[model samples]
Structures are given as C-alpha cells and as structure tokens.
Target: MELLDQYSLSWIIGLVVALSVTGVIAGLMAGLLGVGGGIVIVPVLYHLFTLLGIDESVKMHVAVGTSLATIIPTSLRSARAHANKGNLDSALLKSLAPSLLFGVLVGTLISGLVSGLVLSLVFGVIGLLVAANMAISKEPAALAETLPTGIVRHSIGTGIGGFSTLMGIGGGTLSVPVLTRCQVPMHRAVGTAAAIGIFISVPGALGFLINGWGVPERPPFSLGYVNLIGFALIVPMTLWTAPIGARIAHAINAGLLRQLFAVFLFITAVRMLYGVWA
Candidate 1:
C-alpha cells in the first residue's frame, strides 16, 4: 500500500499484473526445465524496472537479485516433485552446493565491477553454447558413473555458480548439461539441477542484498538490491507452476524434452543478446 503511494494507481496495477504473468511463465519453465527461472525473470524485471523509472545503474542489480530470491522456492518445489520419483542425485547436489555458493558471491562482486551489457553478452554466449549442446549431443552420459571429486569438481561447481549468478539464472541452465556430460542421466540431471537452484538462489540473493545495501537509486521496498514486491508476487506463481513442469518433464520423451528445452535456452540467449543493445 505504502509502496504504491509513490506511484499512480495505474502503474501499481500494471506492475502487479506483469509480475503475476512473469511468475506463471518462470514457474512453469523452471518446473518443466529444471531451471531457477532467472533467465526469464532477469530480462522481464530489467525492462519492467526501466519502465518504472528505476535508476539505470541499479536496475540490473535489482532485477538479478529479485530473480534469485524468487527462484529459491520455485526450485525447491520442482526439486521435491522430481525427488519423489528418485530422480535426484543427492551426492552431486551436495558436491555443487558449497562451492556454488562461494562462486555466486564472487559473481555478485563481479557484478559491481562489470557493466550490465557486458554481463548480458556473457550470459548470451554461454546460454547459446548450452542450447547447442543440449540440442545436438546424443552421446550416452557415459563419462563417469560416479561423480568427480577434489579440485576439478569443485572448480566446475564454482564456475557454474559464478556464471548463473552473473546471469541471474538458476544454475540448472548450466548444470544439467554438465551433469549429463559427466554421465548423469537426463532425468537425474534435471532433478539435481533443481536442487542446486536452492544453493545458488539463496546465496546469490543474499549476496546481492548485502552487496547493494545502502546503495542509492533503487526501487521502493528493496532489500539491498532485491525488490520485495516483485519477489513476493512472483514466488507464488512459480510455486504453483513448477510442479506442473516437473510432471511434464517426467511424462515427455527425453529427446523431445531436450529439443524443447534447447529451443527455450536459445531464445533466452538471443533475447539477452538483444538486450545488450535494445
């Protein structure tokens, strides 16, 4: 109520409607695709914030931080649905969590150091590679039955964390392919990626919040860089739709799913690329 007092009633209504729609889309995408909804949320929030007149300097931060916060519950819900079918690799999830959190913190720091357009470029490039890998690769996930250990695994986990954080996406966008490449099954990879989202989203969101604390020129009701209103509105919709996505993932053909997911990733990548100039 008080937050809306800063703007016209129409603007507040429009913002709420947009966030609601975003929640639905992100939630379903995360559930079906095992992502944290960051890819979708980041762009939507960035443009929406611009329209709402957020400070140019901080708009990207707010969008990213809020996306991370919103992904936490969405991913958890999706993870639960997948776990019910024993599709999750708990050990792999654990392996990725700690280093991933650290990487996300590192990424948050990197965010302040880099411009949004630069970050968008990086996001687009990585996402495009991920999309291509998923779409074309048909080799058996026969690299290693057991997960890798020591520095190699940790290093990769850290990289995933940092990249996802920088891109404001749940690490699944990166992790699923890596898991499959490491010989993890597709369903299992998707399930575990959902679990990984918790690690990335929670820490990444906190990093942004603390990182942006007392910073000037952010939207109202912001906790550091995280927008409270957007997170609240988006989380519920994501919560509702994520389970449905998990259901679809299980029900569909694996190849078909991969193709569809690849398309989604490709589009997201191109959109991010476009945003660099748009």
Candidate 2:
C-alpha cells in the first residue's frame, strides 16, 4: 500500500519516523518540565517543512498552528494524568481559566495578523527565556503562598495566553515559573501548568481556524490555519507518549531532567533564530 505519495517511500518513512521520535522526545520533556511540546515541535516542524519545500513565507505559521493543534490532545492527556495523581489545583484553575481563555482568543487573532517571520522571532525569544529559567537553579527567596488576585493574575494570564499562542507553546513554560515564584510547590506548579494548556489551546486553535478561513495558500487537508496532516501525525504520537513521560517523571530525578530540558530548549532556540534569519 502506498502510504504517502508526496515523496519517495523512503522519505515518507523517514519523515514519519522522525515525527514519532520527536513526539517521544517532546512528550518526555513536557512531562518532565510541565511544558507544552510546542517548544520542541515548532522548531522541528519548521526545519522539516523547509526540507519538504514548504513556502518560506508561511512555513512558520503552519508550524505554529500545527503545533497548537497537536497540543490540544497532548495537553488534555497530560492534565488528566496529573489530575489522577492529585497534582492539579482545582481552585487555581478555576481562578485562572477565564483570563487564560480570553488571552488565547486574543493571541490567536494576533497570530493570524502577524507575519510568520515575526512569529518565529517571537518564539526564539521565548525559548531563550525558558532556557534562562531552566539554567537558574536557586529558587527565589521571596515567594507568596497564595495565588495572585485582582489585576495581577489577569495580567499574567493575558500575557501567558498571548505568548503561548504566538509561539505555539504550552503555557507551562511561563505558568510553571510564575507559580513557583508564587510559592507553589514545583510538582504542583507543573500540574497546574499542564491544566492551563487545555484552556489556552482550545480557543487559540478556534481563532486560528477562523482566521485562516479564506487564505489561498493553505496546504492539503487543512482547516483555517492548521494543517490536518501534521496534526494527524503528531497528536496520537504525543498523546500516547505523554503518560509515559509522566510515569518517568515520578521515577527519575527531576533536577537532571530540567537541566537536560534546558539544553534542548537552547538548541531549539538557536534553530528557530536561524530559521528567522536564514
């Protein structure tokens, strides 16, 4: 049976194998760091799409949109696993959901309007920030035990929504750090961040769908901004692997994982920046 005709059988097999490996790596990182797989997915997809001769002008957008599309299922799986482990904070989720939802909507809209190069640059910057956070070993001395209220939480939620959507990242990169700084335990913060990914992805994805509606250069099997082909390849792989990552998280040394994750982020950041410039 011919699985894919867009390229040679060898190339198709290679692509599928690469994507599967990426899924495993991204899932492991997400589980170990509480991040959305997007940090890894976007850069990898960008390079892969370039190799496949996707248009330079729109390849970044496709990468980001497709990453977000995959994150929907991946995040849901991660959140459920964390919840089962009693790591998720219901009250914090309840308090943060509204703002997060609104932020995603706004961010998606912004993404539709922005250029793909700009999106790539933004992602590079965010990746650097994540790397910086990961490199820092010491926890902040001043930390609050309670969640922020009033305007602060709303502002942070909005920032998370916009940044996450723009880079096709799981909100966890920012959310986990913020929560940790707010005195939440690291493991609990990771769980909460996983839950936030669901809130960010749903509306953010809808916005992409709505915004990309009439664009003429969209790929085969696409809905609005998202390529269904990429989503199909990634979603199942990520979902299946995420729980495995979670299981490993409980069994391994988290500090080592975070350092390894930081190294991975640094590499991805450099690649993304290269894509933006080259």
Candidate 3:
C-alpha cells in the first residue's frame, strides 16, 4: 500500500526488527511492572513515528491508540502467566472492570478535545509521580486491611482507567499501589494489576478507535489511530516474552522486585518527560 511506499524495503525491515525488540521490552515490563507495557509502548511509538516522519498532528494519537491495541494480547498473556502462580485477586478484578470501562470512554472523549501537547504533559507528569511513589514504597498511612468499597472503588477505578487510556498505559501503574495500600501483598498486587490491564486496555483501545476515527493525516494501515502493521509485528513477541517476566517476578524476592521495577519506572519516567520537548 501507500504506507509501504513511504519507506525503502530495507528501512521497513529495520523498523520491524526495532519494533520487535520494543515488544520484548514491553513484555518484560508487563510481567515485571504489571503496567501492561503501555508505558513502554507509548513512548517507543512516539519516537518511532517521529523517525518514520509521520504527520506531526496525529502522531501522538496514533502512538497511544496503537499502543493500547497491542496491549490487549500482551495483557492477556501476562495476566495468565501471573494467574498461574495464584497471585491474582479475582474479587478485585470483578469490582474494577465496569467502572474502569466507563472511565476509558470518558477519557477517550476528553483526548479528542485536547491538544497532543497537553496529553504529553499529562503523561509525563503523572508517570513521574507514579514512578516516585513506587520507588519510595512507603506503607500506607491507614494500612487499610480491605479495599475500599462502593464509591471509593468507583473513584479508584475511574481514575486509573481514564488516566491510563489517555496515556496509553494499562491501569496497573495506579492499581498496584492501591492494592498494596489496602494491605495486599506486593506479589498479589502485581498479579492483580496484570489482570486489571485486560479490562483497561480492551475498552481503552476501542475508545481510541472510535474517538480517532476519520481524523485527518493518520498513517496507513491504521484503524483510527491503531497501526495494523505495528500491532501485527509486536503482539507475538510480547506474547513470547511476557512469561519470562512472570517467571522472574515469581522467582525474585520482594525487595529485589521492588528495586528492579523501581529502576525501570524511573528510567521510563524520564523518557516520558522528555517526550514533551521532543
């Protein structure tokens, strides 16, 4: 197609190789951080799009949407792997889904109305805050033994879904902290977050498809903003590698897991912040 003509064959091959590598890292992040790899995927897409010389106006939207699209399979794989270890919280998964889906729609609507610059700032700032929180690993003030019920669940789910959709991330960055604060163990929090990513990513990706539909200057092989080629090449690698991260997560000590994941978050936080300027 016309999109294929935009680059030389060798270049396209190179891009695929690079994207495959991104998928591997994304899979590792999905397992290690339970953030559904969206954090890694979004920024990487942004950079790759820039390199590909895609139209500036739609680059962020395409990046976010495609990242969300790829997240579906990746999340499914990572969650299943985590579940195999009996780490997931089934009750929490049921409670979070409905509200999270609603919030994703709300966030998608909001994204269409805002500028890409604003979204970049939002993602950067929030990512930095989330990374800082994880790195610190402070115990919650109340050390609440049970997850809050009713409106609190709504509040938490809505916040995670809306924000994650906008930033093209799984809701895990927020979910893990919430679970841990409720006195769930760290491993359970990670496992549960992996499951929650499925809920957030599926509806969130669909919302992006609908919201960005028919917008101008989108790159080829795209449904709304989700890039077909990128999705095709990345999903398998993500599926292949997510289990590796899960294996490592289960094998690592709590303190080691915390530190390993903290360093990743910190590095990604800086990369996201840099997106604003780039």
Q: lDDT by residue for model 1 over 238-269, one digit each (tens)?
A: 77887887788788775777678789778867
The residue pairs in collision within model 3 are: none
Pick by lDDT: 2 or 3, better one: 2
**Best-first order by TM-score:** 2, 3, 1
* 88-121: candidate 2 lDDT, tens digit per residue: 9989988888889878877887887788888888
lDDT value for model 2: 0.80
Error of 2 at 224 (Å): 2.2
Query: TM-score of every model?
Result: 0.83, 0.86, 0.84
43: Cα error in model 2, Å: 1.6
lDDT of 3 by residue, 1-278 (tens): 66567767777777677778878887877666555578778877777877877787888888888888887876787689789999988888888888888888888888888877767777778877876676665565645888888998888888888998899987777788778878888898988887888887888788778777898777666898787878887788788887798788887675566666667666665765676687
**In model 1, what are the clashing residue pairs, if there are any?**
32-245, 141-183
Model 1 spans > 4 angstroms off: 1-6, 32-34, 51-53, 134-146, 244-268, 274-278
Q: How close is candidate 2 to the true structure, as a TM-score?
A: 0.86
Ranking by lDDT: 1, 2, 3
Query: lDDT values of the candidates?
Result: 0.81, 0.80, 0.79
Between the candidate structures 1 and 2, which one is better when assessed by TM-score?
2
Runs off by more than 4 Å, candidate 3: 31-35, 81-85, 137-143, 245-278
Report the candidate with higher lDDT, 1 versus 3: 1
